[model samples]
Target: MNDHSTNKPIDESWVAHLRDLSTGVEPPTSANPHAMSRVAIRRTRTRRAVLTTGGGVLTVAAVAGAAFAIGSPTTSGPLLPGAPTSASADPSMSAEERRAREVEAAAVRALESGNVPAGWHVNVLEGLVYALPPEIVTSGPVQDEPGVTSDMWHSSEDPDSPPFLRMAYVTPDYEFYDTKASGLTQTPGPDARSFDLPGASVATVDDSAPLSEIAGAPEADPDRGLVKILVHREDGPGRYMITMNLGTADPEFVEGFLTTLTLS
Candidate 1:
């Protein structure tokens, strides 16, 4: 869990000290890492619905010569041209619009800091970074909330194929709590598990349905299973949820692909 190939371990104590110094108080120690509030559930549902319908305020950026690192060999190349320069500094934009722009820029920076396989198409959206096979197309940075964004991807030219992957980033708006009414409870069931990710205090994985399916349309394959990975920031208030809807994809491939994901 090194910071973006720095090979330097994150200083948790120093980070905590800084938080305390800035806030003049310590974060709550009793925050439950698992409880899901009604607001949170509703937020999640709204995000998925937007992804499913491919409807939202969309912004695209073209990242040329962006690089990223992964366990596999990688190559550097120009990506499709679409996105404009990050304009969070635009004086006319609302605070929410500025936040969304900043998140998208951070996502691009994350990709540029690493490398990817030669044939892969890198996706930078909503402060989440990952790569897809050449056959898949991705879209978004959909501003679900003031600070939350989502992206959806699926095979190209196949309108019938459901989006096999969706990713979202939620900026923490409240202090962490474990109570049933205000925080997240661990995703129930024996299949739920935890992961060790960089710069995260808690990372959990569990079964889920594709956001598209959750929105309404039934998946083409009833037997297909999707897995959701939730990662909570260690140094700040933010979290990322990545859904891999296992359709015709191999589970191992999905796991390996996730290794390339970068979040800010």
Candidate 2:
């Protein structure tokens, strides 16, 4: 699909490149060796539980401007202030601490507003709320290793298909700097086109490439192929990784979806 706003066609080459990257590299090994085993164990356990439970879809309740999970209720209480400025400003504090403070501040602002955008649902868990599109289906919050909470949403008609969206929130104790650093290192080549978005960095790649990662899948389907949008942000007390895998290649839809994002 083309981005009418920019009059440029969406790129598909990077999607294939990403699939190759996912398969080519070994499973990610955390920078902290001591936490690796625990993360693995927790991930395995969570996966098994989700499979056995048939995946629980979280129900959200919109109150004023905030969204709250029906099962995991959160109070619309005032947030504490006093978050530090940027890392450069705080020489005595560690990177993780500074990021945590920023995340906390963002969360507070989100909670204070309690606003849920139109046509989106909120997945509230562990004192955090995320606004997401209604077309996507998820099994509440999935654990992506220790200190990391992940929520994945895919087409309800085909759970095995590529996900429409995935949000991973990393807690303060986890090493978010290393995680973000690893992703930043995988920069796209000069051929990839870039786009502008509020509060985000965007890029696109399209080419006639074979699909070697998924068997029996078409090289590129008009309605469904590989469209990966990676958005990473560190706010008040956490680090968020939001990914959008669209089947229609509609950049407008991606942009609209992102505009609705609110973290409380």
**Cα RMSD (Å) per model?**
40.3, 44.9
Worst 10 residues of 1 by lDDT: 59-68
Per-residue CA lDDT of model 1 for 1-264, tens digit only, reads 765674789899999998888887657678554565766888999999987666433321112222222222132343348844334223468988777767667656655666455567666554556677777777544546555567777768683565467676666542222222222332333556776566777777765433334434354654565566777777766667667655544666666566666655
Cα lDDT tens digits, model 2, 1-264, are 875575667579988888888887787665986688899999999998886565332223234225233322244443347843334433678877866766666655644555545666655433344556676788565657776777778877787765556656656566553343422212343444444433434333321122213223365565543443333332344455454555545755655544445434
Query: Which ten residues in a row are the worst by lDDT in model 2?
Result: 206-215
Per-candidate clash tally: 18, 18
> What is the alpha-carbon lDDT of model 1 when measured against the actual structure?
0.59
Give the residue spans of candidate 1 off by over 4 A. 1-115, 125-127, 140-143, 173-190, 208-223
TM-scores for candidates 1 onward, in order = 0.45, 0.38
lDDT of each: 0.59, 0.51
Candidate that would win on lDDT: 1
Q: What's the lDDT for residue 34 in model 2?
A: 68
Clashes (candidate 2): 18
